[model samples]
Structures are given as C-alpha cells and as structure tokens.
Target: MKVGLIGFGKTGKAVATAILDNNELCLEWVLRKRTLLEHRSVPEFLGIQSDEPGLIYSSLTTSMEELLDKHPVDAIIDFSSDQGIYTYGEIAAKRGITIISAVSHYGEQEREFLKELAKQTVVFWSPNITLGVNYLLIASKFLKKIAPWVDIQIVEEHFREKAGVSGTAIKIAKVLDLEESDINSVRAGGIEGRHEVIFGFPYQTVRLIHESISREAFGNGVIFVAQNLAGKEKGLYNFESLLLPYFYN
Candidate 1:
C-alpha cells in the first residue's frame, strides 16, 4: 500500500515511520509547508532509512491540485491544518480516495459537510487518534448506559506544549449529552495527558480516567490508525468506532 502523509509534524513523521515499519506499505508522498533541506527523504525526516533502492522522493508543491495530481496514494492520511483538511476531504471524497483525518472539525459547517460526504465515501474523523483515548470514549458510553441518570463532569490536563483542551474529554462530553463548556481543559508542564469523566449522584461517584506518561504513547496509536485506514466503509468514523469490538462487546 502506498500512503500519502499531509503533515510533517511529530505525529505525521511518526505515522510515516510506522508505515515504513510495516512491510506491507510504502511512502508514496509527503506534504509539508517547507522541505527540510538536509532530510529530503521521508525516512530521514522520520529518522529511519528505507532499504529499498530507487524509492521516489515526493514532489513538494503549494497547490493541492498539483500535489494530488502528482502522487496517487492508496490512502491519504491528513494531519495538517483544520481548514486545509476539510477542503482536501471534499476533494478526496469526490475523487473516491480513502481519507482519514486526525483533526477535530466540530463546527456546524464541518458537521454538515462530513455528514453529507459520508453518504458517498468512507472517512474517519477524530480529534485525537490514540487507542487509549478511544477506549476512554467506549468506557464513557457504558458508564452512561448503566447509569444514564448520573451527573457527569469531565476534566483533563495536557502538556503545556499542547495549547488546547483534551480532545478525548470533549468527545466524552458529547456522548454524555453535556455542553462543550462542561469539559474542562488544563495545561501543565511534564504531563503528557490526563482525562477523567466523573459520574455522580447524591452519594457516590464513578470516574473513568486515562493518562499518557509520554507523547509517544499517542504517536504509536496514531500510526496504527493511519496504516489500518484503508478499504474501510465511507462515513464519519471515529476511534471509538474502531474499538467497538473490544469495549462495546
């Protein structure tokens, strides 16, 4: 399988490395705003080299049409700008390409676009793609089902490097029928990630918490999702949807 990576950031580089690690896949193209002068090859960007000789370096261009036309990948894994992703998704859907994105497109327009696109193609949309976070979503649903009438509150913390709230917390909040503001986001140094959804009543509380000791934990899971995103159904899918068998059953 040939993969196209749309971002050259930490997670994008991680996904490229993971794809190379999988003997069944190859890097077809990579997109970044500026090419790294020293590390032109995807392997070098990911800190690994491909043993396969004559492997092509992707064409670097600013235009999406040029990029898509130059390289035809089996699947396009987007980890780039939120706006860029949705625009590309529309194009990918029309072109009948497999698209998996790791950005949260949560506004009214995004939801409407994704809902319409799902009818014609399969796509996976999630704010975060970590397996543990997906598991947290699954657990939250069960806790809600068994204790539907319980009061719910979500709190989460991430590294200061991460400027936003925990995406997983937001997802859980949506599942529990809580307002988006109900999910609290905290930024702190030395904390890779932390999330807890608490269910409370008059006298007791049930909490589900998932933490990450290092950012690499999420890197590993994100790569796994990128590689496995081929040939899946066309719809707005989430990591929780992928983990349905493990926790839902």
Candidate 2:
C-alpha cells in the first residue's frame, strides 16, 4: 500500500524508516513544519538503500491539496500534532484516503472534526499507537470485565521532559472508568515510555505492563492498522476494536 506520512520529528523519522523498510508499504512523501531538508529523498536522508520516492516536503512551501493532487496515497499515517489533521483531513477524506493518526491528545473540536471525516473515509486514532501498549489496555479491560471487584491502578512513566500526565494513562483511566486523578505519573531520565496496570485481587496481585523500547513501535502499530483497515467501510476505529478479533481466534 502507498502511504503518506505527516510530521518528520524524531518519532516521525522512526515511523518513516519502518515504512521504508517494509516491502509491502511504500513511503510516498512526508510533510513537516519546517523547510529544512525539503524535497530530499527520505531513504537517502535516513541512509537506507531504496528506490521509493520518499520525498520530504515542508507544510509552509507545499499545500496539502497540492500534494494530494500530485501524489495520492492509499493511506496516511500521521504522527503529527493534534492540529495537523486540520491541514489534510478533509482533502484526504474527499478522495477516500485512509487516515491513521497517533496524535497524543485531541480536544472536543478535533474529536468532532474526526467524526465528520469518518463519515467520508476510514479513520483510526490512538493516543498510544504502540501495539504492546494497546494490547495491555485491551487485556486490562478484559480483566476488569471478568473481575469487576479487583482494584486496578494505572501508572505511566515517561521521559522527564514530558509535562503533565501521560495521555495514554488518561486514556486507560477513561476506558476503565477511573478518574484522571487516579492515574500515577512518573517522570524519569530518558525512559522511552512505560505503562503498567496493577490489579489487586484478594489472593494476589497481577500486573500488565507495556514498555516502549523505542519509537519504532508506533510504526509497527500504524502498519498493522493500515493493513487491516484496507477494505473496511467508512467509520472511526480505535486500536482495541481492531485487536479484539485477534483475541477470539
């Protein structure tokens, strides 16, 4: 499948590299905020040997409509900011392009915008797009269903530079019907990302933990979503809904 990437920051570069390495996915172009390294081959910049025209474009220089008109893609994997969707969502939806966004947070306005976009095309959004983290969430939810009396606590650890609580932790809390204040946030030195759900039972304690060793986990997640979302009807999808089928069979 042909894929366009939004955002070329540290995480974006990792995701682009993962796409370039995958034989089944083509990295079409990447849109970033700055003009630095504009129009450069993504593979060349990353020191990968591939012929796919993984070009880099600056949002300032190239309009989203111009880019989509010139080079249409089957899907767009966004690791950009929450506001990034305003730039390309409607244009891509009009053409029926799939959108997979991993933006960490979105306000009510963004959520409503995504709902409208879903009416036109397939849209999948996740705060934590790493497969393992999502799996942990699913498993935790399952455990909660079976044992409603268990005491569950969410703890999220991230790099010290990150401000506020982890969005993923908040998502977990929301899913489990816990308050935001119940989440425990730990900031440490250079930790990629870690989330643990502690389940305290009468007899023993169980823990489900997902540690993101690197940003490439996000790439793996979008690829998984893109492959599965290929022929689905227009709708908004969350990662857990897509994963639930796997647990059954």
Candidate 3:
C-alpha cells in the first residue's frame, strides 16, 4: 500500500519509519506544518536504507491538492492535529483513498465531519492507536460485562509536560460507561504512556495495563489497521471497532 503521512513530529517520524520498514506499505510523502526539512527524504532523515520516496513537504509550501495529485497514495495515516483532516479529508474521500487518523483529540464537529467523509471512503480514527491500549479497552469491557458490579478505576500516566487529563483514560472510562471524572491522571518524568484499569471485586482485583514503550507503537498500530482495513466497506471506524472481531465466539 502506498501511504501518505501527515505530521512529522516525534510520533509522526516514528510512524513514517515503521511504514518505510514494512514490506507491504510504502511511505509516499509526509506533510507537516513547517519547512525546516522540506524535500528531505524520510530515509535520509532517519538514516535507514530504503527506496521509498518518503519525502517531507510543508503545508506552508504545498497545498493538499497538489500533494495528492502528484503523489497519490492508497492510504493516508495522520498523526497530525484535529484540524489536519480539513486539509485533505474531502479530497482523499472523493478519490476513495483510505484515511487512518491517530489524532489525540477531536470535538463533536470533527467527528461529524468524519462520518460525512465515510460516505465516500473508508475512514478510521483513534485517539490512542496503540494495539495494546485498544486491546486493554476491549478486555476491560468484556470483564465488566461478566461482572457488572465490580468497581472500576482508571489511571493514566504520561510525561510531566502534558497538562490536563489523559484522553485515552477518558476514552477508557467512556467505553466502560463511566464519566470523565472517573479517570485519574498522573504526570511524571518522561513516561511514554501508561493506562491501567483496575477492576475491584469482592475477593480480588484484576488490573489491565498497557504501556507504550516508544512512539513506534503508534506506527505498529497504524500498520495493523491498514492491513486489516483493506477492502472494508466505507464507514467511520474506531480502533476498538476494528479489534472487536477478534473477540467474537
């Protein structure tokens, strides 16, 4: 699959590197906000040997239309901001390109926009796209279903620099039918990311934990989504939705 990447920050770079390394996926180009490394191939920047173009382009210089027209891709994996979709969502949808977005947050308006785009092409979005995180969420839900009276506590830990509550924790709470206030956030020294769901029963406590060791986990999650998403019907899908099938009896 030919892939276009939006966003080239730390996580974005990791996702691009993962794509470049995958034999089934091709890193076509990357679009970012700045022009600092414009036109530099991703392989050159990462110092890994690969033949894919993986060129970097700045949104300041290149319009989304120009980029898509010149370097068409089968899918676009976005680690960009919530507003990044506005740039290429419609264009890519109209052309039937798949979109996999790992943006951390999106309001109701952006979500509605994704639903609209799904009418034209496949669209998948996840606030926390790591496989382990989504798996933890699904398993927690299953546990809750089996034991509805258990007390559930969610705690999320992240780097100290990240202010406010963790979005992934909020998502976990929602999936388990808890309010945002039910989540506990802990900010500490350079923690990549960790989410723990504690289910307290009368006799014992079951904890489900997922820790992101590196940003490369995001890349791996995107690859898993892209591979499974092939030939799916057009619709808006969350990471859990893509993973739910595995738990079927």
Candidate 4:
C-alpha cells in the first residue's frame, strides 16, 4: 500500500516513523507549504526513492492538481490545519483518493466538500486517533448508563507549545452530547498530555483519566489508521467505529 502525507509537523513526523516501521505501506509523497528539510532526501529520508521533492516526497505546491498529477496515491493522511485539510479534502475528492484526516471536524464548507467527495471516494476522518481515547469514548457512554446520577466534567492538559484547546477533549465531549464550552483546558509547562473526565455527584467523584505519557501513544494509533485505510472505500469514518468490535468483544 502506498500513502501520501500532508504536513510535516511533530504528528506528521511521528506518523512517518510509524509507517517506516510498518512493512505493509509505503509513503508515496508528502505535501507541505515549504521545501523539504535540509539534508533529508525527500524520498530516502521518508523511506522511499524519488527525485522531485514536490512530485515525490514533499511537494511545495498550493495547487492540489500538481501534486495529484505527479503521483496517484492510494490514500492520504493529513495532519495539517483546518484550512489545509479543506484544500486536501477537495483534491482527494476530485482525484478519488482515500483520505484519512487527523484534523478535527471542519465547518459547513469543508463538510460540503466531504459530502461531495463521499459521492465518489472514501474518506476516513477523525479528530483523535489514539486508541485509548477512543476506548474512553466508549467507556463514557457505558458509564453514563451504569452510573446514572454522576455528573461528568472533563479536564485536559497539553504541552505549552501545542496550539488550541484539546481537540480530544472536545471530541469526547461531543460524543457524550456535552457542549464544547463545558470542557476545560490547561495549557502549561512541559507536560505531554493529560485528560480526566470526572463523574461526580453530591457525595463522590469518579474519575476516568487518560494521560498521554508521550505523544507516541496517539502517533501509534494514527499510523494504525493509515495502514487500515488502505484499499478501503470512500466514505466518512470515525475511529470509534473502527474500534467498535474491540469494545463489544
């Protein structure tokens, strides 16, 4: 299986490492805003062999057609921002490539692009790919039934350098039908990650916590999704749906 990557940030690099570790998939190309990093052979550095950095390993094209024209990718995994994701989704839909978007849910226009894409190709999108977090999504639903009276509140912590609030926390909140405003964020010093959803009532608080000992935990799951998405159909899919059997079994 051959895959294309969008963005070359921490998450992107992490996913690249995981893909290199996998024998099943080959990274076809990476699309970024800038040129390839110094000393990293666009292809060999990414564990592939190709000459055109833009066409092969990392294409610095604003136009999607140029990237698609060069290499017909089987699937694309994007770790880019929302705007970048919107552009990539449009291209993937037009080119009929399966896309696994790691970015969170896009707005109306982006959804429209995805809807159009669904008519022709398969698109798998998720905000958080960490298997543990997806498991928590399930546990949250079950716990709501089991502990009927407990009130749930979520607290998340991330590295200071990380942007925005916790997308994972927002996702879990949405799964539980809670408002995004209800989720709290703690941006602080060198902590990698932390999430604790507390179910409490008048007398007690039961906490369900998932702390990211390292970003690698989530990165591993993203790679797993990329590998699993190979040769699949075109449609919008979620991580929890992918893990349904594990939770049910």
lDDT per model, in order? 0.70, 0.92, 0.93, 0.73
- Spell out the clash pairs found in candidate 2: none
lDDT of 3: 0.93
TM-score of each: 0.82, 0.98, 0.98, 0.84
Backbone clashes, each candidate: 3, 0, 0, 5
lDDT of each residue in 1-249, candidate 1, tens digit only? 666777767667666666676676667777666645323666755567685221223335345566667666666777776665654676778777777777654666776777787777877777877777777788788878987888888998877887666666777788788888888888877777788888887788887888876545545675666555666777777786677755546
Q: Which ten residues in a row have the lowest lDDT in candidate 2?
A: 222-231
Candidate 4: stretches off by over 4 Å: 36-63, 201-204, 230-232
Tens-digit lDDT string for candidate 3 (177-249): 9988889889989999999999999989999999889899999999999999999999998877788788784
- How far is each candidate from the true structure, as Cα RMSD in Å? 3.3, 0.8, 0.9, 3.4
Q: Please give the lDDT score at residue 17 for candidate 3.
A: 82
Write down the TM-score for model 2.
0.98
